[model samples]
Target: MNEERAASEQEAVENDVVARVLASFENTPDARLRLVMTSLVRHLHAFLREVRLTETEWESAIAFLTAAGHITDDRRQEFILLSDVLGASMQTVAINNPVSGGATQATVFGPFFVDDAPHVERGGDIALGAVGEPAWVEGVVTDLRGDPVPGARIEVWEADEDGRYDVQYADARVGGRGYLYSGIDGRYAFWGLTPTPYPIPFDGPVGDLLTATARSPYRAPHLHFMVSAPGLRTLITHIFVRGGEYLDSDSVFGVKESLITDFVVQDAGTPTPDGRELGGRTWSRARFDIVLADSE
Candidate 1:
């Protein structure tokens, strides 16, 4: 009887602690902020109680987060990597951006997106120094109803076959990133290096966490695209290689079935999509159509 009474008292104390913490948000002017804080407090306290988290474990977690912060810089983002590996980013995207009709599925924005990527002409080459087989990517932008969305700005970026983006290099002059606008037919095309599977920045705390959890760090080969039209919601997505490695085990959990595309290999001497002949080097081609949802 005495033990039961003590347990009841402990439960009451835990519940009171959560309540007091939630009450501290009462004066927050923003309703959304207050609600978010309250929910966070509730969940955090519940998790602590459920796991019986120890002070030492809490300190270790804090140290891990501190390490993540320390390793972040202009070239690398450990926090975003952390969020990606934990599947939080994908979950947040799914919660806020449910697809309507045949709109392309959304994926991670990744940590390497550059603002104001240089615009390129249709069929232009973006793989200036990328040392891989040339990949010709062509696409059309359309509304969910299949109407062409001419003049849509299509921003595209991808890592080389070596799995490195331009920003990863010290010179920052590496290629494989560019943008183009769809023509009257809603068509856009550019040349990029075929993407190859690469590990997320695996020299940091997130990598350490993944190793500790026995998780692979490889992400599937893919090309990132952010397409926007005047009356449509901007679409952030990736077109993954159909047979790419790590599709089933993407380190970031960013793959979608709808985004997998076949990268067809064209032998040497074959004519390109724009009618240029590939003399001695093999090339690849992929066609990915993007459909955007109507803006609210």
Candidate 2:
């Protein structure tokens, strides 16, 4: 009888703590804020209760997050990396962008995007200094009704064959990223490095967490794109290499079947789209037509 009474008392204390914390947000002026806070508190407390988290474990979590913050800067985003590995980024994307009307599916936006990326003309080259097989990427930007969406801005970036983004270089070189606009015919094309599979940075807290959990940090080979046009929902997505390894287990959960595409290989003497000589080096080509959805 005494043991049962003690257990009941513990349960009462836990419930009371959650209730008090939630009640404190009852007077919040913003209804959205109040709702968010209430849900957060309830879920957080429930997780703690379910896990029976100890003081030491909580301290460890705090320290881990602190380390992640310390290492973040203009070139690196440890928090987003953490979110990607935990599947939170993908979950948020799914909630915000649902599949409908044949529009392209949205995916996790990795942490490597930078503002003010160098601008390239249509059919221009984005592989300024990166080393890899030359890639010819061409596509059209259109709406659901199959009409051209002229002047859509397209931002593209990808890793080099070395599995490193341009920002990861110590010399601060810029390559493998540029922005272009669709022509009047909705067609856009560019020369870039062929997409390559690469591991996420594995030298920091996020990497440590992945190591601790026995998880892989390698993302599938893919080319990233962010397309925006007037009166359309901006799309952030990727074209994953078809039949590539790691597609089923991409570190960021960014792959969709619709995005998988063939990277067709061409011989050294093949005629290039822009007639640029490859000097006996083989290259690849991929076609990815985009469809934009109306913004609600």
Candidate 3:
């Protein structure tokens, strides 16, 4: 009788799971969402059945998730990293962006973005207050047809030479705290030190997972960009530095072919805009245009 009762309870739990999963779609207003949810539920259940996942494994996953949550703070976004490494973030972007022929390819936004960075004028130096090799990044926002989209806003951010974002360190002694707004012609330029490849924080559970998987925690050198304007879809992407190690193996799997750009080193003898002799050191320059999709 006890064995029979156990079987009945297990069956009841399974049925409840199915019912609840199906019921979630009843109030979904969007037909697409309803369909997606239904399919997701079916596949999820199928996966469980296929795996025959043990309760111990489920408990371990829950514990890992709990640790991931516990490691998150204002500046550290382990959950975002978790989503990134899992490819869920990129998958969502791909689904939403849906290659429209000429639209810019969307990628992960990463976890280090900070709102309301101190804005600077066009061609201004974002790394002025910091230290590193000087670099000038200039670009225009255009449609796929190469027509400039004037007044498009290009929000940019990057890590310092030390591979740490401004918010990552509380000392304020590290660099990387600059923001630049593009001009009316969709032209934007800013000066900063070249960003270097760095390892993601490995003190958390996600890091532990990566370590267990024998994956390196280093990201390729890249600059983050978010371009948007009225009547255009926003683009969240990165311009990876060409020839940088880790391009083929980004820790978070955020690299894309179209986004890889060469960082040209200009001769130090070049004339400066202010008539000052250009510093006698090689500097990197990357220029890429962003194409935005038309908002339907």
Question: For model 1, how does the per-residue alpha-carbon lDDT over 27-74 read when each residue is reduced to its tens digit?
Answer: 999999999999899899989999999999999999999999999998
Best by lDDT: 2
Give the backbone clash total of model 3.
0
The alpha-carbon lDDT assigned to residue 76 of candidate 1 equals: 87
What TM-score number comes out for model 1? Answer: 0.97
Clash pairs (backbone) in predicted model 3: none
- The digit string of per-residue lDDT tens for model 3 on 121-216 reads 777777746656677788888776667888776777878778878777787443464566556677788777677898888889988999999999
Q: Which stretches of candidate 3 lie over 4 Å from their true place?
A: 1-38, 172-177, 272-279
Off by over 4 Å in 2: none
Model 3, position 288: C-alpha lDDT score: 80
